[model samples]
Target: MAEIVPDVGFLKNGKLKTALLQHKALSKSGLSERLFGLMFSGLVYPQIWEDPDVDMAGMELREGHSIVTIGSGGCNMLAYLSCQPASIDVVDLNPHHIALNRLKLAAFSALPNHSDVVRLLASENTRTNTKAYDNFIAPKLDAATRAYWDKRTLSGRRRISVFDRNIYRTGLLGRFIAAGHLLARLHGVDLTEMANARSLREQRQFFESHIAPLFDKPLIRWLTSRKSSLFGLGIPPQQYDELASLAAEGSIAPVLRQRLEKLACHFPLRDNYFAWQAFVRRYARPHEGQLPTYLKPEHYRQIRNNVSRVKVHHATFTELLSEKAAGTVDRYVLLDAQDWMNDRQLNDLWAEITRTAAPGARVIFRTAAEKSIIEDRLSPAIRGQWTYLAGRSQELNLQDRSAIYGGFHIYTRTA
Candidate 1:
């Protein structure tokens, strides 16, 4: 079977590629690094885990805003359309992700109504999605993207069959989530029971009682301590190192414990589709209306109306930024891509971003480590162009329902 992700060469020649080769070699051995590299090379996050609502709050988009964001699963880009931005340029190195973003826009444009759009994306019967894609979306897509989804997978099924089969359940994160459920079962915990908990108090009780104890087990500690075991969670070797550095003890288990606690207990489950996905592995019952902001019924009209505001590219953030004229971009969402970059790459990206940023333009990103990577790695001249909104960033981090990233940063153009 052809792999869903063919390569992780988003940054072709650099320290990043060197690290990828080392990780790929490690993958040849049966541990997690190979899987992480393979997954990183493909569609990893079927549904992005970041909190778009928190991102929207921080962006404070005005009518004239033009934003640029990394298109992971294309969820947040769709969510931001509701803010009525003038235009949004969504870029990613993964062609599949660019296709996903394109598919979303086409669906919104072609579907008869909002409910049909919801049924196509959120419901289990992929026939709805497949038919929708064939009759509605396919004609609108560029030839390259259409061919991507039309290509058959290992099963002799067209890649679009993924949507028909519950796309959210397919991808590296999906398989990883399935593994987590399996792990929980071995420890006498039912993740679904935690998912269906009636209240936040019940949620907290379940985590403390049923889930928390599992982290203390020898097996989990052993698994999580290895950098390879976390590939499903989309942690590259560098990210794993950053996460490991957060603790003086260097045990990822404790960090995992804390993040899981937040995922299970921090927010109202009725409202947090992220938690439902973590525990139940699907969005909240479609009837109950728990979904990502982009999938919510209330925002459907605005999103569909504004879906045209987005333009997608299979390109890196720096490459995309370098093409724009100075002082043109107003908002940026980098989504942990910085963690993958070395100092030279960081400096190059920030240089373009600095040149392209409009007055008061804002950039937000997540980090695998708790510290701001730009502070130490970026040249002082490039870094000085932006002011770190440290207090607000930390506050947003606390409220992030995804509860996985170590830090969420917000930086504003100072001049």
Candidate 2:
């Protein structure tokens, strides 16, 4: 195992300060270093991306197309495999994310049955899972993962102890949400009751009472105004800037409040799975303890089989895209990743994207604002070759799960 060093200076006095200072027009090098710091400090998570069911629907993905995706946490890639893609390549800069992806693949590959896998991951309780880990998974893990699982935190248990709790809060964005909840609580707000509202009106009332007070706080407003501070929320600095810029006086609280209001009030609590994860810490479960639609029992075999079709690599998008032969990939799921790139990186990435795209290949991704990042950002020559399906992408989006995403987009290489 590589000996990990604690660079306390970076967190307390380094690029974090630079990021906060130049929140709006963060340079490429600054953004890269900040992201690397986030990855190293474990502020970036194994699973901070949005639900893939929402993403796949937005992409309108069909069978027999290969995809390339950023593997923040492995959940979405597994979700994509359920649709029977020809292949998927999961890329990440964080080794921890790769470790988590490998763990998911290992579980699917070696679990005794689908039931055991569910009992471990989907259940949110790891008692049975720890037993399963000890008996089944622990011995099989590679040295790195074994060390990750074995390392103890200040709480005395291993980091693997997180599986027993609402482990969603362990991720980068999850930690931000947890902190937000704490801050909200300090202001006499309780987010959990947004669930008990019986109607849209009731939901509105709940938010007004329970969620709105934090937005009024000076500290919350100040922190919300800065884009780079939101890296803790798993938002890239660029995307955070765009979202912040959309509001009057560059106040982000109103924007976040409005979007979160939509997530909490626009749909039934039982149906809005994002709210379930956010407010209640678990999704509504049937008596049999079934997972979400994208993670049904029957998909396990297919996911396990298609697991081989995907490879998780710890590298940047440009690095991986540079190695692939032109016209080899059929689909690309960028998942709002482009918002993190600077002009040069964007150009390099799209250059490879244009070169690697097969005829009629589809590319899908989300953004932090309600426009395609590729439109103004990509070179005109490259952008002209890919036809954007503006009308189709809008129709596929579900308002409930996707309230936080700026917008979903799908593009196809010109035939």
User: What's the TM-score of every candidate structure?
Assistant: 0.92, 0.86
lDDT of 1 by residue, 158-276 (tens): 98888786888888788999999999998888888876578889999999999999988999988988888888877787788889887556468988888889888888888888888
* CA lDDT of each prediction against the hidden true structure: 0.81, 0.70
Query: What tens-digit string does per-residue lDDT give for candidate 2 at 1-415?
Result: 1322222334653323433333332877466546645544563654545657666766667788778888877788888888888988888655567677767777777778888876666667557676677778777677776777767888898766676665666777676777877787788777766657667788778887778777878988988876655777667656777796677876788888877877777776655566766675565566422345445777887887777777776566667788899899887878777776666667888889999988888888887887888788878887888888888777655542647876778888888
- The root-mean-square deviation over C-alpha atoms between each candidate and the true structure, in angstroms, is 3.6, 4.4
Top candidate when judged by lDDT against the true structure: 1
Q: Which regions of candidate 1 deviate over 4 angstroms?
A: 1-35, 286-289
RMSD in Å for model 2: 4.4
Model 1 residue 69 distance off true place after TM-score fit, in angstroms:
0.6
